[model samples]
Target: MEGLFQRELDPRWARTANNASHWATGVLAGAQYGLVAGSVARPRIGYGVPLGAGLWGTGYAVLPAAGLYRPITSYDRATLAKDLGAHLLYGLTTAAAFAALGPARCRARKAG
Candidate 1:
């Protein structure tokens, strides 16, 4: 994924810089996703869909407007669709993993 993103960036940017940016984005995104998941009274795997969608929407729509990235309109349809699908999947899987872990922790605490 970092490689893919690097390819999209300006060629003048060093590989190290692109890698750093990719890592930072991933860390920040994970933190944000975790916060969204934790905010719910009972985090469910299904919640990830909306969470992911929200993030995707913000990234595509807001990021460009804020000068963080190129505008969504500038991307070809295929790229846009690919990004949207990827984000939704990311959200679903992340939420599902969190939901799965949550029950076990609760059960362990109760047993203890």
Candidate 2:
């Protein structure tokens, strides 16, 4: 925001906005996965890696176009590998957690 205009930013608000954006992105991704996995008879943990890799690759393509990041080619292989590794972990953990929770119908049946 400061870059767009000459005005200074309030650090507290900046942090809050940053945190909110991070959370919103995570929530959106989780909801999307839930919708997808809910339709499956068995949701596999392995499915999440492709989701994560897709998100990472999409960011590389979209962020650069939006001017948030440089082209993927500008980064070294090691750096890209490390970033992709983190994203893969995110995907795996998301899938694992979703699987552990099971479906809402299962939980309802168990409760009854």
Candidate 3:
């Protein structure tokens, strides 16, 4: 914000906004995964790796245009790898938690 908007956020507000956005992103991502997983005959935990990598790639694709990040090429391998690793971990955790709930099923009532 300071770099792009030329305005500084209050420390408290920054923390609050950061936390809120993180949680919101996680929830939204989880919802999308749940919907997709629930539709499949058997949702494998491994699918999360691709989901997470796709999300990471998406951020690289979009954030640069938004001025929030440099182009992917600008980052060194280590940096990219670290970020990717974090995303992968998040994806795995999400998949594991969902799997723990047992097989997915549609809870909708049948139309009479």
Candidate 4:
């Protein structure tokens, strides 16, 4: 349909989708952290695990800002490499975060 085509071709729609996805991901990550905090008897471990998760999530959410305001410089193969490297770093950081969180809710609850 014409309406569908307009929506699909719009850059604004993609940006909105990206922002919404980021917000949802952050909230879910925060909830996972809270669940981890709730499950552990020791408030320290409970807090630490979630804190780590949250720190990483927050870092992930803000990291896009770094690439957003890049300086206008000469373009070269090196520039391309650096951009790719940054993206790769982002992916690795995201993996490390989820791995570190590692299903904090999966273990059986400890009896009080």
Ranking by lDDT: 2, 3, 1, 4
Per-residue alpha-carbon lDDT of model 1 for 21-77, expressed as tens digits?
Answer: 646765687678777666665779888888678778887776565454677778998
lDDT of 4 by residue, 1-112 (tens): 1222233335556677557765775566556655654564433423443454444445444533443222333447686566555544544444455445554534433332
Of candidates 2 and 1, the better by lDDT:
2
True-structure RMSD, every candidate = 5.5, 3.9, 4.0, 11.0
How does model 3 fare in lDDT?
0.77
Lowest-scoring 10 consecutive residues by lDDT in candidate 2?
1-10
lDDT of 2 by residue, 6-60 (tens): 4555677777755675578768888899888877777889988997898789878
Q: Write the per-residue lDDT of candidate 3 for residues 11-95, one digit (tens) a residue.
A: 6776776577668877999999988887776677898898889788987897567655578999999999999999999898888
Best-to-worst ranking by TM-score: 2, 3, 1, 4
User: Of models 1 and 3, which has the larger TM-score?
Assistant: 3
What does candidate 1 score in Cα RMSD to the true structure? 5.5
Residue 72 alpha-carbon offset, candidate 4, angstroms: 22
TM-score for each of the candidates: 0.70, 0.76, 0.73, 0.34
Candidate 4 error regions (>4 Å): 1-9, 45-112
Q: Which prediction has the highest lDDT against the true structure?
A: 2
